[model samples]
Target: MSQGLPYDKITSAYAGTIVYPPKGTYGPRMQQDLQLVLLHTGELELTIDGSRHAVKPGQAVLLKPQHQEYFAFAETQESWHRWITLDLASLTDEEQDYLDKLPFSMPIPEALNTMTDMMLALQNDYLRQDELMRSLGYSAFQMFTARISLTKQQELHPSVVAALGYIRQHYMEDIALHDLAGAAGVSPEHLVRLFHVHHQMTPIRYLWQYRVLKATELLSQSGLSVGEIAARCGFKTAFHLSRLVKEQTGSTPSDIRKAAWGTAN
Candidate 1:
């Protein structure tokens, strides 16, 4: 089977969120488009062509086109979920087959929530989502699939997961090794060992890299000045931001920004 599709090539056609009432049911019928469902709360049992798959809270399921699909939501409470429809006509046979062979149930990637929030900040409503935001969301889908593939290769340590979640949420703030450990509910030494084992670096190194990554995004996507971007991304100053941005991307902040706007000097 194919490993996966090129992330940049997987564009999103439409995306939206839904909340189904307890025991809600839909369709022992057909789905015409390729869609991915991310369940945030409660449960979902998807019956596709006589195969039943249970999708729990924090899980995702990829619904392929031309399937006799059925959806059964939680019986006790409302179920919250999001769906992103892929641009199906653009996929090659290998890519389509790779998606088809994917498991029916997988955990909803944390990066999806982060990406949706980031892109949503650019476009206030899904109904009014602009092409640029949709493009960014498409990249997010690729990230989801890439991360899922990596996860399938190796299960992440729970402490690493917890620490990473905290970092993603608070990368703009002042963070220390103890703070990371506290978030992961581990001691400083244990957290460091875990990071070294999984990430091949210390937690602080990861935090700094994450800050630079976010700074790069803001530099490309927002009109914020270098200093402002630095402040928002937890860099000590514009110099720090530029230094790391150059180190990580081999391009200075202004150059990256100009390139993103198609006017690089």
Candidate 2:
């Protein structure tokens, strides 16, 4: 028999498709909340707390709070992943402990297909935001969590998890591969291999992507100019920041700022 979820309500839900650049990557950082991601098409690779896993159609990645996870599309392919973020505080201590013990990735059981479908349906209801629809969405989300709790679980490599934490906390500064390796208490070469095996990129590349992501948030939410944002985000100059932003997002820093401001107003 399956165990029930500790929570009675889902605070929020979302469904969307993300197109990753052929060589692009996202995250090697800790999640602030619990997130369940269902990959509908293509492939998505993730390193959860140093253990690497690949999620495909009908497979889901369950990310617990404070777990260091990073994701990227399979090489040269596009991925369509559905996701829902749950509020961990809503869960009872027992439920939270159960969730914490589950594997990072698992197959979405055939019986739970309906609930997976409901996730997308819930996404629609959430967007509509009508009282009845929202209530229904919450119910569906609760059922989804209940079913998910029964799946198999995976483990993480402690050393890699620690190394990822160090990188995430200090990414805003100039970081070197050896520095990361030292922090992980591993040889520099071994750390590079760990990064490749797990993150699919070198430590420095992961650091760069992390900085760029932070810069994008600042660009959209703050009044800081590109030059200031560059320095704050660890870029050597505005030109470096602009080039990377354009490469990663296909838009210049000025254009991104304008678009963000336009949306805010």
Off by over 4 Å in 1: 1-12, 119-130, 154-265
Instruction: Give the per-residue lDDT of model 1 (tens digit) for 101-177.
Output: 76665777765666555444444443323344444545455555546645753477888888988998999999989
Model 1 TM-score is 0.54
Candidate 1 colliding pairs: none
lDDT of each: 0.72, 0.62
Q: lDDT tens digits, residues 1-265, model 2?
A: 0123422334444444466655558887888766667776778778877877877777866677767888877777677766656553466676667668665666665423443454454444345233223323333343344344322112334556667778668877887888888898899898888767655567777677667767877986799988999998889999999998665444467755654454311
Angstrom error at residue 218, model 1:
7.8
Residue 202, candidate 2: Cα error in Å is: 50
Give the Å error, residue 153, model 2.
14
Which stretches of candidate 2 lie above 4 Å from their native place?
1-4, 90-94, 110-113, 122-265
The CA lDDT at 153 in model 2 is: 16
